[model samples]
Target chain A: MKAFYRWTRDLHLWLGLFLSPFLVVYAVSTILINHNATPGRDAPEETSGPVLVVVPDEEDRIRLGRDIIAQLGITGELGGVRRMPAQQKIVIPVNVPGKRQVVTVDTTTSLATVATKSPGFLSGLVYLHFAPGQHLVGISGNWFWMRLWHWMADATVYVVLFLTASGVYLWTVLKAERKVGLICLGAGAVSFVVLVCGLLF
Target chain B: MARRGLTYWNRKLHIYLGLYFLLFLWLFAVSGLILNNTHWTFVKSKPVDVRSEEPVTTPAATDDFGMAQDVMRQLDISGEIHAVNRPRPKPPHDLFFSVVRAQYFTFVQVNFDEGVANVRVRKWGFWSGFARLHTVASMSTRGQNMFRDWWMTKVWSVCVDALAIGVLAMLCGGIYMWWQIKPKRRVGIVCLSLGCVSCALFVIGLRALFT
Candidate 1:
């Protein structure tokens, strides 16, 4: 029993140390998102010279955009792809954590103009907060880094679940702290119940 | 003596806050996992649909949301008023809006001319209900970034903020306690530095590495 408790403590300490940065990202990003304030929200845009890339016949926008970006060699996740028939162009948005660059291709001339905007550091945190999100339904990430981020984010949460249980165990063993800890736990439970019921019922 | 007292209080606060936020953090973590891997067989949400029509009198309110509230009251539907739209379709329909709770989404489309509101309620099981809790603040659509009108939204948002801040506090306290263990300081520094560098590289270095 003593050995088991020691192992749990070590697991909590080491995992908590190694994953603290990722944990802080989730915490800070949630607060920033709640306030509707992320840094680099108003970063300026820069447009680059047109690069030639053929827009081939394809029904799916993401597939077509992927083909186009594959030719350009710039890496980022693709947002919704739409074509402006009047302008004879297809516009695609490519997004990384800190930057969003729009690729507009002239179906006629085959010239692609890239408009890039950097949303800065905190926006990067916010972007990482919801990368490879639940939306885009059947579509998977085309960018390597975005896909990697999905795993890292999920792994961090898994460790977090483990940490929560271990934390409770560690608290329970500290007899001097038990009274204060239970008080805090009970208060949180009641508040959580009220908030959830208020939202649902 | 003062420093000793400060250290003692810090430890107490850390333990207390950790216990307070134990279940609070657990909900977000579990729901977050469900959302992150939404394609999982058991957690994938398939909302059950029920469609009906409710008779509603034209209320005196002129604004779109006020009229939505009036219609909601008439029909006994409750949840956040996600959106309200009147495209003024040919021959005029009364109002179109959706009310969404954690477990169900009720879409209401009213026809003032006919004195009937066509209602569709799509409900989901707990797996999806918990998933819905993860995104209560993010109903913002393109061209519709209205402030959340529901009090529940405000409370939920504030709680999330508080929980996040508390976690950060506990993080600092945890590190302080580890530092007090003289033998673990070297290893702790290494682990802490690795985390900081890895996150920095992922957040800022990825674009440079890939592009």
Candidate 2:
């Protein structure tokens, strides 16, 4: 039992150390999101640049938007596309590092207007919080660095789960702070249950 | 006074950082579960009652933003006006504005060409309101509103950055402490290797299967 306690303690400590950075991102991002305290709410800077080549007979606005983006020399994953039929324009939102740029293309003239915004620091952090992972098979096309980040995020999840379990064990075994630890653990467990139940039922 | 050994300090750091992280841990765990299972009807939303007035004169064709401002002024819906949507320049293009408060949200849609304004209020239930916080990131007021924007956006962002670094330190210290326990070296390696292998396999398998 003594050896078991010692092993558990070591396990908990190492796992916590390795996984804490990712956990912090999760915790902070969750809080900021919950409070609506995310940054980057300001209007983007708009600039009318060179006209983009009009895709002949391309009715798909997303494709046209992508084409326009390529022409404008913007590099990043396509985040979203908003089509405004009334204005005969397609707005494509591109997610670049620490910034979001919008490309507006006029269907009639095939001219493009680009608007860029440096999403506030919090907003950028939030974006990092939910960045998507690249696929392992079937045309794995995301950037190499982004794929690495996605892999890290995936590994972080399992590591965190392991750490959470080990943390509970550590709390139980450490007699010196068992009472206080139990209280904190109970608070977390009860809050989780109550909140979830309140929402579900 | 006796000097403390490295292990003692390491354990102390671990304990304190763990304790400090408790509240945030709980918040994320619960909110994360909620976010993951959004398909569940855990949060219910309803349209709020809105009072409509006579339609005002249509604003100029090029000034959709100005028209939206006029609509807000007429309806007396005050808060940070967030442009929700600006449709194309065709006739009857509706301009959408959103005002988010602590408890509820006010959405105003105006058809500038038709000179019509429709206001809708969305009252969020407790769970829904709580869940909505996960999606809230706005800087409607930057420098002008220091008290609100500065504290909420800028200050909170700094906290997140610091917490990130602190977490990394905690992780590193934990591994070092574990390494010092030579007797358990074999067991530690086995367990860590198992974890890493399983994680790698799961990630690879998932990507192969899904994507």
Candidate 3:
């Protein structure tokens, strides 16, 4: 029994050390999300840009989008395209590493306006929490280095599961404080079950 | 003095829990900030290149899925098809297919009338990559062969479910420990109350202003 306790204690310590950085990031990010505390630039940058010169003969929206992106010297991947026939406009949204730009073209006049927003340091940190990983068959467009980060995040979920299990074991070993520990455990279990039920139903 | 043993065990458990989950707590707090303020420019994209080829005859297949495969083969794009959208609003019905790879996303639009497919590839940077990690969840069977796909998804999804419960346990353990530690009970109670009250007030204030 003593040896078992020793093993659990040592495993818990080592795992905690290994997961310290990830835990800190998750904790801070969660609180920020809860409070809606996000810091960023004061205002988005807005500029008027030239329109596409070579509009496709077939009026292909995608082709027209590419032409506008080229004419305006927009840098980044095309995030999305929105067409408003009533307004006679087509909006192409572009995303960069830490910024976003939207180029709106007046379909009738063929004029374009571009607006860009750069993220702040806090915003960047917040985004780290949202990194996507390769799961099942859907591979993200992130490179190996970025994919490594996602893998770490995925690994953290499993680590947390182990920690919780180890925690329960530790509580069992500490038989003297069983009452308080059991109460806390019960409360947590009830909260989890209730919340999960709420989510499902 | 009679409760010394209980106090000792409480402190031990509390310390261990703190040590174990400290970083996790911090991560959630910080990432939460980014999610709340999406307007911030944390991710930036730079237009790379546009490649095209001679227009080819429309694929014999009429369905979007089959056509998407044909487009993928023609473009030499490698990845599983994430989504295919066919908005049947008006003429010139553009067929959109989102192809995802490990390092980039290829957005393909097939214009049947024009006999052309426009391909746009987007690469995510470090911050954007990090943001993606925060939102990672269970993979749906939509684009996956459930039986043959990677087992990581099944394992990770179960872990995530346990994580929710673990977090609750951690919070409960923390509060109980705080209550049991007589030496620090007063300060702990004050801090805990302040945290709870402030959180409630802030949430209430936000709802009042936004909702």
**Against the true structure, what is each candidate's TM-score?**
0.92, 0.52, 0.40
The segments of candidate 3 whose C-alpha lies over 4 angstroms from its true place after superposition are A1-7, A36-38, A41-43, A46-116, A133-139, A143-145, B1-211
lDDT of 2 at A74: 71
True contacts kept of each: 0.68, 0.05, 0.00
lDDT string for model 2 (B47-151, tens) is 456555346556554565566666667776554454446334334646766665434567776675677777777666666556544333333432232223212
lDDT of 1 by residue, A73-181 (tens): 7778888788899989999999888888899999889999999898877888888887766777555476777778888888988899999889899988999888878
| lDDT by residue for model 3 (B1-211), tens | 7578766665666645433443433333344343333445654445354545436457777877778777777777755466767333144546777764323567777777888777777766544434443433322232333121223333433434445444555555555654554765565555555544433322232223221
Sorted on lDDT, best first, the list reads 1, 2, 3
Model 1, CA-based lDDT: 0.83
Stretches of candidate 1 off by over 4 Å are: A56-63, A82-87, B86-92, B140-145, B208-211
Q: Is candidate 1 or candidate 3 better by lDDT?
A: 1
Model 3, A82-143: lDDT tens per residue? 78889988888764434557898787887788887766444544445545422211223223
User: DockQ for each of the predicted structures, in order?
Assistant: 0.66, 0.08, 0.03
List lDDT for all candidates, in order.
Answer: 0.83, 0.56, 0.53
Residue A65, candidate 3: Cα error in Å is: 11
lDDT of 2 by residue, A80-150 (tens): 56678899977877764356677877877878877777664456556556655211222122434444555
